[model samples]
Target chain A: MKGTGCISLASCKEGQTGKVIAVLGDKHVRERLEVLGIRKGTVLMKKVQQMGQGPIIAAVGNLEIAVGFDLARNVIIRVEV
Target chain B: MRVLLTGNPNVGKSAIFSKLTGIDVTTSNYPGTTVEFFSGTMNWKGKTIEIVDVPGIYQLNPEAAAEKVAAQMIATGDVLLNVVDATNLERNLNLTLQLMKIGKPIVMALNMWDETKHKGIQIDVDKLSAILGIKVIPTSGRSGEGISCLADAVLNAKQAPETNWMDKDRWKTIGFIVDKVQNLSGRKHTTIEYIQDLFVNPVLGPVLSCGVLYAAFTGIMRLGKLIEKTVLSAFEKYYSHVILTISKFLGGSGFLHEILIGETGAGGVDFEAAMGVLTTGVYVSFGIVLPYVFLFYLVFGFLEDLGFLPRVAVIFDRLLKKAGLHGFSIIPMFLACGCNVPGILAVRNLETRRERFITAVLTGITIPCMAQTALVMRMVGENDGIFVLLVICTLLTVWCILGLFLKSTVKGITPSLLMEVPPYRLPGINAQLKKIRMRMTCFFKDAMPYVLGGIAFINVLRITGIIKLMGKLAEPLITGVFGLPQDAVLALIIGIIRKDTAVAMLAPLNLNSTQTFVAVIILILYFPCTATFTVLLRELGAVDTIKAVLLMLVTTISAGGLLNLALSTVYTPRGLLITEILIIILVIEILEPVKRAATEKKQ
Candidate 1:
């Protein structure tokens, strides 16, 4: 498990496909993320967005979620290809 | 039964559809393409069920994009899941009642049930069901809460006799049923209560607002540079070297090479031409815009979700009303910062034609879009800090001044500030992202084709002798008036197609810092974007479109040309600094009187 500093989702490069190590959120948010399948060990590919690493387009299965720098900072991901 | 899922924008309609069909239709590309009802098959109780995700909308009367699609969906649904934003019960119910008036086998899915709980909102589900004469399934699509119960409710509604939400004029009915069954205990904004006074405490609000904006710009720039270096460097190593060779091998000052590569002959390296779109267009789209756009969306969404936008709405309300519009018009203007199409289209919800016209034109002209903002922020912000601040300050000043101009300078009755300030909430993560994606996707999709095509077409225009002719024809004003080199005509021509490409065109020119500033100003005030052009044509028709163009043309030439001339003589380091300070003081002083007059008028 590793924590990366805040980077836009679009800029998450290859070989750094991260395991979503944690999701820090409030109540509705906790539910929202869980519903969207953004859970612990959820394998996520950083889908390069219109903005690289500024807003990482994180994908789990068919769900694509854009995370800005702030939210991404809190999301510890196990960086792996 | 063919089931239709529908609701107001950002409601759980798509969320529910995704849950039911397990299908994700990228809801991003709305501005570029019209997505009718999306269909996917679901297996329910060992039987194949066809599910349709209708576009979200407020009314069957069909105002917005989703509304039209929903109206179309309702026209042909066997069963309808009328998803309601349960927290905003009254607002959601208004639309639900409208759908019920249509006499469909409707199932009211109360989405966002989790939020309703926190708000101390109580909707007796059974009572609401009985009152509406429809099965009401209170659902939280977020946590997978009550989803099965919702599915069961849909199944039950299919077997049972159908019912309506209301039989007569629904507000009258809703006013009654809601009066009895719905209890909205106004929760002390536990929520944002502590921050409310802090965020908008007159003096405190301004300080906080300025501090936040300053931080946002600084944060985006600092982070944006790192992302750009990382993303663009990787792209260059992969693509630039390859495309450069291929572009060289083609070896022609001819149409094909020019169109394929740029006229500057810096055709990125091999495969890079094919791939440099990622390097340049895609990189610009994501990298440059990403940091700031994300920041913009995050900050704006937080402000929005925290209910600050409404307070801003309250502040801007009287100003908006003066221009024959309401404070709601500010949304489109805000959205205009992303891009102008939706910003323009969003004007449709305005109460009157005059409001839409003024808002559309003003948004088109005044709002520096993502592409332009990206370019300005990237080039100017990175290279010079104080100048960048100056530009941003100028932008804000212009927005306020133009807003006041639209409100007062134009002779029209002040519009109303009739709006619903949604309660402040810690904006949901997924919801905020969903909103951001919805916006940025619309921007990217609309711009991508035009950007690629504009680059290609600019290349084609150069070799085809079209640019030479344009340069010559526009020489008098382009050079003589605008005080720019004839090459600037090319930038202006390209600006019509896409603004960033026009600025990108400036890279080849050996212009000094002052010239570039003038160029950017010209780009901002010069003309409406292609998307904005179409919307203007649609909303104002031909005559106003022409007037709009003329207004832009006169302003661009005058503003840009005058600034250029003035700066050339007066822009010695000491003089320019002094002038800026004086202008700042003058502006603040001008604003004080205006505020006083406005307050006096109010009294």
Candidate 2:
């Protein structure tokens, strides 16, 4: 629950993919996101930073989403890496 | 045939157009979003295909610029080429799915195919097409990969049956379909994440954020000097030679020659009689503004490509929110470093009216663009040490005070910040050079036309004695109200006309140190340039725009009065310039540790 010791996004040494449980943004924003289909169970995967502090990029399947140090903090996950 | 192309920001939509049509469109990582649109035409498959590059939006229901324009395009477009970021498929597919539901003949072009291989991403193209029920073409516009195939797909789709994907509510529904078809790897927590968690943890994030702010601001000025040195000399050489040849042919000292191109005194190039406007007009825009502006965008593009701006948002988000704004508002502030127009237009992304109001005011007033900054630096750098420090400190102080004051006065109820922090990529030299070339071309095109017209207008006015009449009319306010001379009044008029032109105007005034400082202050606040004016008018409306103008006038006058009083009365030789810099940095630094300790204590 706290830290993925060595798991990777798909099957690497450090990342894992997961679904969005809730896009718990503020009301207007949350509503807007819901309309965009960026809602509950929308799959995402954090590509653990290979360097620096940790995962610099995240993934949702093949698509790469670069995660700044700040955003990766808000994303919560149930690991299967 | 109408073909609408849309993609996420930083994708090659505009690049594709230029390759297709031979039109050079200015592209940028939208200071606000990662997306925007460009439209051009290409002759393909025996028909003139009018391709509209719809601003790349994440969805049709967009609150941001690209998304809004994108949705509007969808409602009207006949053929949709939804350009998705191949490197970021699932997030991109979200957009692709939305486009499909727009009911147009939708095809997805996965731009940046080379990045996928470099990043080691694998895409199941056949599976994706089957799931989405639309054509998906993988492309590498950079390497000329799959472009012909893409053209063929477009040609084929235009000829094929009409698909009514128009149920937009389906964007909300398609995530489930994406889930069934897309086998994503699962998420897992790791020690590395835990390590990252330390930096991103709310308590520490703000501290790290502050450090980044200090670094970026410091870095901009410090690196700005190095970059200016590298490029300025070449610009000087090239322009001097070109103008020298032109002047020689026109006979530099001739009555016709002197007005079109001024004698090279200090900085003024005398063009003959009074039409001298035409010569200097070309010089100021193409010679001065062109090179400097192009350089700024090149640096800006590099910074953007490195993904530093969003992190900047994260850093500033706390202070900005105290003003009842969000981190995303930083996008406009950052862009304001370029121009206020796009900066103001960027405010539309803010969720509420109040946020937009505050953003507009801050952008117009506090954020000085490359033009302003260049002139300010030129003056300050040339001046005596102490006054330069005061000017710099005064600017920063005013920026902070305005943010605080507006936050207090403006009524806003929204305070949320959700932004993606793209990984810091080293801006490729090839890409950087291309971006710079494109930007310079755009800037030269945009500014050259305006300058030539303005100079020509002024020339016509000068011959008719209208500039004198205008200057005479404005003299009372210039001398009495703003404490500047009658001649400097003309500079203010030209300042509002074009910043570079105004800078050129100042070279002939022969003002002493204090007068130079006063002139700069006047130039900085007179009025938004025409480009900014149009954007502000478009974004904020006539009444609000008027109010903003009034605010600028009052603030500039009051500020000028105070500065004049201070300089004339109590000015000392050795002021607190260095002390100010140190104290500001120290204050900025100290806040971080104190906040961290407090957060830790609470935890």
Q: Can you write out model 1's per-residue Cα lDDT over B1-603, one digit (the tens) per residue?
A: 788887765565666777787765443211211235678877877767778887666556653443555687687887788888776565567677777767668888888888877768888888987777788887876677888887877776742244443344454555677777788776654736556435434345546755765676566556656776676677578655655665668783455555655433343432222213423455455545555566666666666555555444433443444344555677777667756776776666554556766787677876787657767765655445555655655444444555555556544443333333344456557766776776667666777787767667666676688989989998888777667788888778878977766776676566666677777778877787686798779867898788668767766676667667767876643455456556555544456567779999999
Q: For residue B97, give model 2's deviation from the true position in Å.
A: 3.3
Model 2 misplacement above 4 A = A1-27, A33-38, A42-81, B7-12, B15-22, B28-37, B118-120, B158-258, B261-275, B322-324, B339-357, B409-415, B425-433, B452-477, B571-603
Point to the candidate with the largest DockQ: 2
Worst 10 residues of 1 chain B by lDDT: B26-35
After the best TM-score superposition of candidate 2, give how far the Cα of residue B13 lies from its true spot, in angstroms.
Answer: 3.6
Question: Each model's C-alpha lDDT?
Answer: 0.62, 0.61
Candidate 2 chain B, run of 10 with poorest lDDT: B266-275
lDDT of 1 by residue, A1-81 (tens): 334443322245633577766666555443334333455556677643222112233555323343433445555566663
Task: For candidate 2, give the docking quality class from DockQ.
Answer: incorrect
Over the true interface, candidate 2 deviates by an RMSD, in Å, of 7.6
